[model samples]
Target: MGAAVGAIVIGASAGALDALSVILPALPEGFSLPVIVVVHIPPDKRSVLAELFQAKCRVPVREAEDKEPIVGGTVYFAPPDYHLLVEADKHLSLSSDEPVLFSRPSIDVLFESAADAYGPALIAIVLTGANHDGAKGMRAVVDAGGSGIVQSPEGAFATAMPEAAIAMCPTASVLSLSAIAAYLQEV
Candidate 1:
């Protein structure tokens, strides 16, 4: 039942709470893979996602800090208004780069960088969202020989993101939100 993956990356926008609430809590205690998340959010509003999820999750959950080393068995959500990236050495980095797909903390930036850093040892999951931000990132993961999973468009609260990812990488596994939670737990 081991997923040979070194790290996991997830991206979402609209309806992200429902998806994350399901997925994060199901990770068994001491699960070893590091999870990095990007959820489109307001540029000015404070992000409480880390605090919100930490209470509900078994694993350590926090906001990604610039230059921090990425740790296994933890979940990190990108801070609002910044792009989160994985350095080749596997350290977490923050960028004030221009937003992608009109969203700061763009999913594409995180996915693309993580794809390069972890390559075949990575898994990228695209969940519910309202835009196409994650499509290019999913393709990058696939091209880098990493695994890609997309939430089924039909079951997603906002289908555009999942549909776009599926269209971009037709070979990715398409599953329901609950199924996605189960899948992550098994990894």
Candidate 2:
């Protein structure tokens, strides 16, 4: 009865990044779902994720600005050195608060905030990474009545992240990158 899908949040790590470039293009054009991405970038560096995705995805991609409104058909990246959060009204909030799991732009921060703001209307996808950053957050999504998905461990360049997510939540779907894009279209 609530929103079918208010947003999609993706958490990615170091490996399998090249494959993501391939997977992003397969998403439906002009999709109404807003996408928020949390990627591990070095603390002092600037993110090229927006620029990289801009060329590959049909949807507009930009770094999340403080207090920016969350909009559909757009992809917002968590800027390096800050944790990006979603507000109750579906706007963005950026914080330089203490890092979790040694990550500034933490996947858990975004996922937890999204769970609080959107509740049942969110979809969380955890991709390849060396750490277990997204596992707790994916569990938060499931607890908030949202869907939780992870890249299949066998398909990932780094299996730790997906494996952790699966360990935390059994119902989390393990999907290939292409399958994830397709499922997003259907969801």
Candidate 3:
């Protein structure tokens, strides 16, 4: 066994729901890392992502609340219109801050903050998306000595985000969606 991973952060955009359906259901109930997800979604609409994933995933899944503590064996989703941040104390904080790259709940915000909080204990993953939103964030994770994974562009529904991340963080592992799921299960 290796040192326990403290947290996992995932970012996705276009075609995210379908991708999540595959990955989320594969996570085992005993997973020991706090999993945080940021998927591009319409900010104005109420999100049911938590409810949907909870139904399929054996592990507990819910929308992240402001000031909540991050817990292992749980999956937390950034709310539609707020930036989700992780503190050094391992508590979550929500910010109504301006959107980044036109996304309110930017993947960069969550990934960067989690990387800062968890340092080498963090694992960051970038999935399919139309833009390069998560590229710099993944770089931050790697710079902080955290590991990074990017879905292979060929395996993504939208390749731009993964491609950008791979370009920016050349050492990051490039895995297919199924491979990523398997890796998570093993973790």
Clash totals for all candidate models: 0, 0, 0
Per-prediction RMSD in angstroms?
A: 1.3, 1.5, 1.2
Residue-level lDDT tens digits of model 1 in 42-92? 989899999999999999999999999999999999999999999999999
Q: What stretches of model 2 exceed 4 Å from their correct place?
A: 1-3
Candidate 3, 5-123: lDDT as tens digits:
89999999998998888899999878888899999999888999999999999999999999999989899999999999999899999999999999989999999998899988999
Q: Give all candidates' CA lDDT scores.
A: 0.93, 0.89, 0.93
Per-residue CA lDDT of model 2 for 1-187, tens digit only, reads 2468889999998874575675666777878888899989998887888898898888888999999999898889999999999999999999999999999899999999999998989999999999999899989999999999899989898899999999998998889988997887776
Q: Give the TM-score of candidate 1.
A: 0.97
Which residues of candidate 1, in runs, are more than 4 Å off? 1-3
Instruction: State which candidate, 2 or 3, has the greater TM-score.
Output: 3
